[model samples]
Target: MIDSFETDEDIVVVTEFVDKQLYALINSEGPMPEELVRQITCDLVSALFYLHSNRVLHRDLKPQNILIDALGKAKLCDFGFARHMGRGTMLLTSIKGTPLYMAPELIKESPYDHNADLWSLGCIVYELLVGVPPFKTSNFASQDCISFLQGLLQKDPRERLTWPDLIYHPFLKGDVLVQQDLAASLPPLTEPLSDSQQLFKETQRQILLDRQPRGSKLTKFVDYFKQKISLEEGNVKTVDGEPMQISPSTTPTPDNPANSNSQRVHTSKSREKKKSKSFEPKSQTEESESDEENQVQNYEWLDYLHRSMEEVFNHDLSCVFKPPLVKVATSPLLKRNFSPQVYNSVACLLILPFITEDRNSTRLKTLLESYAESNVVDLLVQGMWTLLAKKKSELDEFDLVKSKQLSSERLLAIENIILLLSYLVYKQPYPKVDIFLNQFCNAVKSRGSSFALVTRHLLTLSKRRPKIVSDILSIYNHIIRILPSQSLVVLEAVIGNSATKAKEKKQIDLGKFLDSPNAMLRLNTCVLIRYLTRKFGASPYKYWDDSIKQKLVRNAKEDTDLKANVAAGLAVEVIKKLELITSA
Candidate 1:
């Protein structure tokens, strides 16, 4: 198949247009052409040999997935379930593929290798040569085909003919060059879509919402229809007797003569207020004019921080496009096991625009209502804390990520949930003194967040739980640059100030902060290390074995961020001078 760069406009795969499928040719056209079958089988074997030699397995190998081009050449298509096995990897356990063409090992749910594809090829080849396939379920006696079928249709995968063996078959070894053009043999294909036609369809899709909203509702329901009926899943479809609605991302352009109001929904009547060129937010009470304000009323005000938060002199904090509206549902959604695709759609609409750390939330309640459902907060508080509190018997976060026991897809689901909770708790300050806040702080010390919703909250952990301390330090390092103001609070709490005891035991180790997949964390931790060194000096480094000290020093110097490198230079200089020890 042909390929293209990763742009948004990929509709269908661009491949060599084949006139007909091998299955259609066999069924519709009168009789099998032995010579043509030989050529097709060679092509099929060639594709499989390339795949198996590279330790790949095409789980599905039915005749319908094979296409015959007008050039009389065959090609394989539809590798939706293909997998790449590592060197010395013995078998795959996931049960998938068409049962009719499935190998004996697959049907028995036994672990099998790439040789499974060869068994399916035996079934197809037998059916192609003789009118019927020789199987336990159905068979027709054929003298010539029996030996070839016997060579491949093995109950044990170990006994199945490998690709190297199959290619040397007597049927394929014979030089039968009898003429048969597949294009002439099969019926003509339907006309292809013109460029103009393809463009028109895409334009229509992009310019308007789908014609049927219920169609999407049905699609959502169909995803879990079995559970919807049996388990009776609950869906939040309406608010105050009105249906949930999704809004168009962009409004109609100035050249369009039709009323913009008529063309699409405004989502909120407050949206009709004249937008400022500087994007200054309208007053919180501006929603008084909105008809639906009484039902879904929300108060919104801009809270700006200087853009100096980035580099201490970047610029002024800029605009708010409109009052942020947390889109609940324009259409219904399956709440259970939500996929990343649906999560991204929500992020684009409600979260991403306002994610800048420079903005502040005055009220956590108002923020949650504007962005997510009421239950999500409860789900966030309960579901996430449970995962965070999981005692690492032997597994760390990286171990969870690279788990061989669970599918990669399942690992993503767990991480997504944890990340969702982090977004929920984002921007809300960690209370310096509160019972409920203490509970949360303890969780942060255990396993805070694995996602990028940087929290402004700084936890002052006095308890000596090693896991919690490690995770809290990770969060502090991750978000130090994102929220420099709060980061200082963290440093003060952990590293101490001038009035503090000079010989306090180091509460948290900065070395565990390394090896984070988040590159920003590495740079930020190095900055914190520089700050810590100015307070504690070279004493910490001197006590450590050479490798630990070398690693800490190398990290600061080798950091990619220019600002971090500068910080490292200052840190290394202070440590070398042993100023704290000399002065004391």
Candidate 2:
């Protein structure tokens, strides 16, 4: 391999890529028959012994470096930092080498000799026979390169093992003669130390060519050191810093309008491109429109209702008895166009639920009685249909639908509705609150739009009224049947959030839905179960029987989504929790 090089720095090396490291091969294939390991160790010790005898110290040695060549012989290649020891000199003061394989003295930054390399050889031999390193720490406590070398290569020097002592040790004495013979056959080391000056110069030239501006001489010095220690290719560029590459093929001929067929072909191509650009995915548009329609309708109605209440209270407080602002200008509804009076009626219909709150029951009842007597309730129902018509017209204009700001507005509106419902439930009696709750649920279910937001509101109500948890779960069950996968993510978030609330009076029974064939739903359910168990100590498995646990384990094992990992983790946690509870 060394013979192909034009220069020492240009030497090329090659090795086979094996499927597994030596340690892994030994463990899984069951130890290369102890005798083979002994022979291999002997060959390796011979190589190290010869290299040291010739004043070459290989500071790094590990099983990974002991490559089995085409003939199944060990060949060591990496020697970017190998050093020489001559005459009586047995120490060198360079801090280098791999951490795990370095001797303790070297780790301590003490000057060391060929014996340091012998210690690393010991580590490799032990690993070969036992499938693990001898001095290796479980948590890698003593593996820091410098610290480990210091201990192995101890400053006292006497503590370090010599080649003769190591070869005869019980751990390495099994086949000594063959090892010594191999060690004795390596060529004598005698080449004068070639200054790495040429390598450094070539590296500097490459760096400058690559357009890498030399920030300081210190950076160049660091680059010089790196080049000397490794054979990695330097980033090179042209002297003028121009990007270098092979040129592209010739351009195509321009269209000739004089040729009528050519003109027609060009026009057709342009039209086709235009048509492709015009086509947008239908689902993306529909989802956006649905979100926007929800926002515009909810905001228009809620804002109107809130203003109507303020006007009513202002008139009552001032004793003005001003005629109620019965009508106002209105925009188109989600699916249809409606007049101002119809819009007011729609707003009034939604506000009726607010009137039945605990603090305002009497006033709300009186107001309802007056509206019934005056036919206001009927007019409001009519207005709702008109608002629906207006919404239909506006829907066409929302081309780039599902704006983030609109979704946020919808969330806020839903949160407000929940707050209003909570006030009603807290202050009103059961019959009245139940009546209003039915009205709220009807409005949500009727819209049949943005069911995720609706589910979230239902979830909040369920927390306050434990009986309502069943109702919300039923609605969620219906939602998962009709909603797309993306929409389901929203519902899952709401369900998971509610399941974790400490204030929830009833446990959310996710058992029925957890096994849904939909992978996303199953994943989401597992996520919720994991979160609940971790955060609230709610073991869904307890609520679910052993059959459910077995089913869950099977599903988790077979599920293809990344959620299987999460499920597996959760399974471990659940098992741990069960063990703890059972022991107690």
Candidate 3:
């Protein structure tokens, strides 16, 4: 598929068009020519070889599932039943695939591997060559054809032709030329929407909304325009049974059309007074006038709403358009027994099929209303926190050798949920202090390693969404009292800030911070050393030598900033105590 996107009413998948299915070609021309069949068989075998070599099984491999282009090139389609046999996966017990093309082992509900697909390929090949499957009639055109059919149609899977031998079999040996892998030829399935593309998509959606039928509820501005025009023409009661409110000075006549919108703001303020007074059981004529006033106000409000929405949608969308670095074909929602409970939660599962983040909440809110059982606020915040914690854990446990592309995909998925959560939290009406965040902090305090992971993840996220920097600092500040050593990674940024003009290195030298001219940097460095002293005692001296300790002692006595002197003095005291203990 080229791209897939979800609308309020439908989910659309875009793909390249093919001429016809193999089933259609076979039905139209009784039996294909041997040469044509040879070309197609080569294509099928080449496709199967690539799949089986990669440990994938196209469980459903019939003629109807194959597509042919005008160039007579055959392509595999409909991987709805595809399965990947990962490392150590010996057999798949699920009974899948169409009955007619099922292997003998699959038919008997036995365990099978990628070889099951080979049996289905044999059935399709016989049908393509003879215009009917071999099992339907025993009659054979030639001895060689019979021999080829018998090798594949064996009752026992052990006797069936394996993928390696089938490709080199006499029927398709010379035909198996090196063919290009389908995936390598196609563009990426999904790409990040550039600024221009985001604007274009917004304009396209608005145009679609405008083209909807006038009376249909889908057309947001159409019916309102009709009502507004009718109200000005006939001086009738509005849609809500109120008489039209037209101020004499601002009213538009055929000759005075220019004055209509000039004093709209003045008229609205006057109408508000009239509306407030009308709330106290006014006469029928007065009530009608008030309702008509509300209709005009509603129309004006909608006009403003559309204008504001246009400004928001057309603004720089790059900050929000975070496409996954690694895209997976299927959503995690469809898979069972997946890790990181965040992916399986109600909020994450709901938005997995759509874009990472959307500013407009109409669709998301509609989905929440439909799919979410409990409170939307609770569901979203809880899921976001769970994902944040898992993200930290994944980063902390990174192993270059063991981490596959799925690990990258998992991080992207977690970020996708986070991006959506940020938008939702900013837009939705929820309490300022979320209970979920409090619970997360409490969990981190209980597990010191979790504090390291959480703080590291938040620090990484703050770089992307700068608005979350305060939250990161808040969590780091509060949690440090309970776990000091765990906050070492986050404090490294404090030391790194002092070395802005210097060449970057993998590890920042903490000693450099003590010699910096900036008093705040020197102060934070003292605090960091104090934390290290509290955590590792005199052990830090082994790595830094006595120069770092001398700098701290000098800062305690001669630093310009008094706070730095006090912090450095405290750090020195801790180091002295650690030194005495070590000597003893």
Candidate 4:
């Protein structure tokens, strides 16, 4: 031991000199004999025990930090990262130590303490046995050694071996007491092949390699798509040996306006031709010719577009539902201020285009534009409730100024949501409509009336606006159709627990829409009524007066829109049947 002082610019200390580092021995000799490792373990544990007894933490404990002198004794150095814990302190959250040897808790940026040093010591021990740290993924085949290492390398600090427990482990049962001095009993050190820093870097590299998931084997894009198309089309070939079929493209319907009409027509004609000839016997020339045509080269760009859409669909868009808690305008008709969560969700969406490579591809750009349109509608539907939270926070202080901006965010949000609900009820978005509905319904169920709140709010606002009646009724029609039983629950919530029949009757009056001039609104109202009667039988009839039933009968025969007439006709039948049953 020696006294030392710090200079103006640096801290310096004097200490007894050492002949070589322990890294020199491990680097050159590979694995030492069993007796020598046991002795080293005993010495290091004793040093750690003394350090812990004084409340000192040697945060960095690696082979490079331990020096061996002329007497062959191991010395723990590197006080740079050491800290003295106060008597009552529990854990340290600051990260310290080398990457290859840091404890899992430290790597995760979690709270940890003295046990971290023990993990580093375990790494050093593993390195001594296999010439590399255990995290580097080598198969060191000794079960006993592995078990001992597992005790120290536990990811959970609470379960890791502490000094008190390590002393009695099977590997160190009777070897806790250092029997002889290292000078007389340990193996001799050889010339070092590499410095400690270089070895540590190599260890770091190996650990990274071990922790990462292996990438899947690459497939040729052309070949893969070719095989996919072949399997999908039943390998139908044309007379000239061409691929005769591709994925059936959709036509622009009233529901999906972006669809391709010509492509759909071509696919329909192809299917009809195949069906008409399947039963007829073929001549010799006809038997020799194949029935399909190859168009893979022409549709390669389409395949790329499909891949991009799949990527967007698979992304976790649910983050939009987790809006930050910020005050929004209470009234459903007014514009609401933007919240931090909205910006975060917008950022998440903007990053989608860059998720796949070839950001410059025109097909990807078009696909993202299309996705953004539909996704905006979905985002409004799924997250509208979050924007409706009535909070009297700081934003309320500037109410007059904010109100004048006339932000139509909430109204637009409501409009798009109802439109989407109507589309889902009628058109059913192509490719995976059922899957989308299943997931959407599950999310709604878990949220517990979040969507219902938005729907009910729109219904209330429609009382004054009048233009949104069709939209609100369409939403109810969708809910009752898709979620028959859940719709009853949501409807009960919407109507609320009215103490008087007048209040309940005023909550939702189906007869008002039946007499409206708007045909779509009347149609949607009829559909809503029909579904309610079918599900609840005569229970909804109690809420309606004789005029409501009379209006239903009038619309059944005289409505201008045929679809509205059909819907009214159906509702009249349901009401009559349910009323008859009630009378019975």
C-alpha lDDT values of all predictions? 0.42, 0.40, 0.49, 0.51
Candidate 3 per-residue lDDT, tens place, 95-210, comes to 66788899988876565666687788888878887887655675644565556667877877757777556767887756765443455532211123357754654553443334
Which candidate comes out best when scored by TM-score? 1
TM-score of candidate 2 versus the correct structure, residues matched by position: 0.27
Segments in model 1 whose C-alpha atoms lie over 4 Å from true places: 8-13, 30-33, 130-144, 174-408, 415-584
Better of 1 and 4 by lDDT: 4
For candidate 2, write residues 127-147 as lDDT tens digits. 664566664434322233223
Question: Candidate 1: lDDT over CA atoms?
Answer: 0.42
What TM-score do all the candidates reach, one by one?
Answer: 0.36, 0.27, 0.33, 0.34
Q: Which residue segments of model 3 deviate by more than 4 Å? A: 1-14, 136-138, 178-584
**Can you write out model 1's per-residue Cα lDDT over 1-584, one digit (the tens) per residue?**
58535433234567667778877877876346666667777787777766665556787888788888888778788776776654323445455677878998778656566778888888887667664554454444344455557777888875766645565667667432222234442211111225774465344333222211112222222222212211121111111323212122233221322221122112234533633131222111111112222211111110011111221122222222212222132111223223222222222222222332223444433444443333343333333322222222222333222112222222222334333433333333344322222333444444433221112111211111222233344344333433344444454445444543444324334443333322333334454565445445553444334543455466555644443344445556656566456767
- What's each prediction's clash count? 5, 35, 2, 7
Instruction: Score candidate 4 by TM-score against the native.
Output: 0.34
RMSD of 1: 23.1
Error of 4 at 523 (Å): 0.1
